[model samples]
Target: MMKYILGIAALLFFSCGNKEDILLPKADRTIVKEVMDLSPIYIFFRVNGKDTLAEVNRKNSISTTNWILNIDKRLPLRLVIPEVMKLQEKRRGDSAHKNEAAQNYYSYADSIGKNLAFIPFTNVHYKMVKPKAEVIVFFDKSNKIWVNGLMIKNDKFKNFINEFIDKKSENYQFCFSEDLSFGNYIQYEIYLQSLKINNGQEFIN
Candidate 1:
């Protein structure tokens, strides 16, 4: 099933004239934990805006060769998931030899019968593509949205996103209050899906 998904992604990669980069979809929680256990270095993501990945890596002497992700479980899935994707992007190599470090990252993913490549779920199969323009979306506890730091009514979300889409805006940064409930978060996720918004980074206050 994993291969099938990746194969489809590869086809999409080519079909789109290689315009977009293919990313490994999110892995199961258990699998992620197992990979972390086997890894020598751990890269942790915190909600506080203190530590950047580069800082942590440099401080720990973490080489790109071996490291696993560690995100706080208390963080909402909506907020943290996109950061994980971004982390994968940060760790990726140049388009020519991107998967060079795959072996160190995904050996454990392979042993679990995933039949994935050296860096399973590590975006090893896809080429790298940089994001276009960035659109900032912030939501308060009341679910009110602010676009590019300007406040807008909730009903205007679709219109705002559609306008951006027309302008070829492919990247979004989603920021929301930490007090939001999982149910509220899912609603926004579904709404975004309905709007055909697929590529974005997320943050929680």
Candidate 2:
């Protein structure tokens, strides 16, 4: 009778441990699409202070007529091209903006990495750190970072590192600062959503 009781207790303990592990929170892989106004969408590209609608279509393989019509149909497509292009141009104008931010993160990570080099820390993954001490967090973009399993802003961290494929190498410094934190031991995460699309295919540039 004593042996049977001990066996049952061991089994129960193992079962509970497995249950806890299974219940651990994980990031969702769903892409939340934001709504935008569908109207006279100005479909034009500029090169050398000239409207290059034809050139944009030729270079980007984006058909303005088809794109406009598809918008009219309310298809499930994100207008990531023109928006991304505009972002690229802006980044080019401010060359040091990205490098400066990246450098700051790397500097901080070097300090921390050296100190905690031997200590094994779980659930903390560093993505990018600049020499200037600007750190980019991976897991912060997901809903898992919040206590309630909902997405919340971390104002403490000076930046949130978002990953997007750049085919043109337009936005090499892909990370951006979402929030600011002025302390050591920053906590965050990265959430991988749906497969990234480039030119209507899963391609990362």
Candidate 3:
């Protein structure tokens, strides 16, 4: 699925859909892991509040070759020790002609895995997105994964509750408190003005 890139923001947003189209889909923990496994490594750059969500893989895509969205200070946050600089930096790794620095970052993130016990979950605040508040989400994979969600109280995450996860539909894992949103993991990519959030119930897409 290595596609070409040009315009920074290339996200495919969904909105103004039928009720059936807006149903919250559940992502099996295993499938969620697979989503990362199947795709190329993803990286994000945050400088001057501008974000560039890019993608790469062990195969074709690499470096800035596959930029998903060249966002200027949008989306959520990451727990990088040092803040991401605005200007793009070319480390020695970039000299490999394959963006080795990014590859290394992917390797490190992959090594950590999503298992909190093996590696603590790192989160970034979704401050720039809708609802205004800094929405924090768990991102522990080599590639950054995003999902549109329905806001619900009680921290309810998955629409379809699993055995290990909390059974309550209202209580999700991503929610900091009762203010949880159901991410349409099986849905589409996040795009500015590309989608709609409906009272945390069902979004346009």
Q: Note the Cα lDDT for every prediction shown.
A: 0.43, 0.21, 0.24
**Cα error, candidate 1, residue 160 (Å):** 1.5
Per residue, candidate 3 scores C-alpha lDDT tens digits across 56-111 of 12243345442221121222233221122221232223555643223111111111
Per-residue lDDT tens digits of candidate 2, residues 2-48? 01011110111122233110011112221212112211112222235
Model 1, span 1-205: residue lDDT tens = 0111233112111222333222222221222233332333222334347632211222332333455432222334445444444656556634554445443342112223443232234432221222223676776667788777689888877887777654345466566666554335545654564565655445665
- Which prediction has more favorable lDDT, 2 or 3? 3
Ten residues in sequence with the least summed lDDT for candidate 3: 115-124
1 or 3: which has the higher lDDT?
A: 1
Q: Which regions of candidate 2 deviate over 4 angstroms?
A: 1-78, 96-99, 102-205
The candidate, 2 or 3, that scores higher on TM-score is 3
Better of 1 and 2 by lDDT: 1
